[model samples]
Target: TVIEQYEFCRVHRKEEIIISYKIEKGYPLHIDFTILPNWIKSLKDELLKIIKGQQYSEYHVDAPGYYGTKGLAIILKTLTEMFVQSKILTTNLCIPQLLSQYLAQVLVPKTAIRLIAEDFNNIFLDMAKKIIID
Candidate 1:
């Protein structure tokens, strides 16, 4: 229902993306990154390997209220950090820690959000390089 509606609104570009879910009594919450780009998906796979067991599920018990929020904020924040570290984006342009944390409840959901964010940052960096060189 919510997913279908979100898809519909997304397809039409009529509304900002919003995810809603209920925490099942025994089931662990999961974030679906299917709508994100392929690079994000691949990065997620890689991060999952590197991070070992520090996945989204580990944060569930600690931050049950954040389950409904989109992982976009975390993704963006990670990308900003990566860019700053690599000098692709200036440190001055980086998002403030307070604001970034406020936007995304968790900073290190390394399995999904962090990986996806890094992928997006890489894609943006590549595009920026191409544009600057061309």
Candidate 2:
């Protein structure tokens, strides 16, 4: 079947972000994204609020991390899976990113996406703990 016909690979890089999907006709659709530092900073700030208990949302979190809802642990595998006030602020938004409120032009796989989100969230949690929350 279709699922049996194709393979998947994950890619990460500094210049650009890419997500590829295989179509039924055996072709692949490619999506590319550029997330600037300011955008990343804005997202970090949003997560910072949550880490310091300045934010609250539904009780459930995405996966196997004690990160809980303490930060960007919002149980969303894709950026488009926005939970509530959750969003990534940026000046550049493609149509799909705009629709999903996700910074990426395409969907990220389950755990990988959440892991990246948590990694960013943890940055503020780990470094500027007292200045932000206190």
Best model number under lDDT: 1
Number of clashing residue pairs, candidate 1: 0
Candidate 1 per-residue lDDT over residues 1-134, each given as its tens digit: 99999898777663222222223322124555454334344464444343233442323211222322354544554544543345544323324434344223332343343342343454443342232222
Model 1 CA deviation exceeding 4 Å by range: 1-29, 32-70, 91-134
If scored against the real structure, what TM-score would every candidate get? 0.22, 0.23
Question: Model 2: per-residue lDDT, tens digit, 20-133?
Answer: 222332222431113322233445445445434466422222232322232232323323333224644333433323533332222212222333444446433323222122
Best candidate (score: TM-score): 2
| Pairs of residues clashing in candidate 2 | 62-75
Candidate 2 residue-wise lDDT at 93: 31
lDDT value for model 1: 0.38
Misplaced by over 4 Å in model 2 are: 1-30, 33-38, 59-134
Q: Residue 66 CA error for candidate 2 (Å)?
A: 24
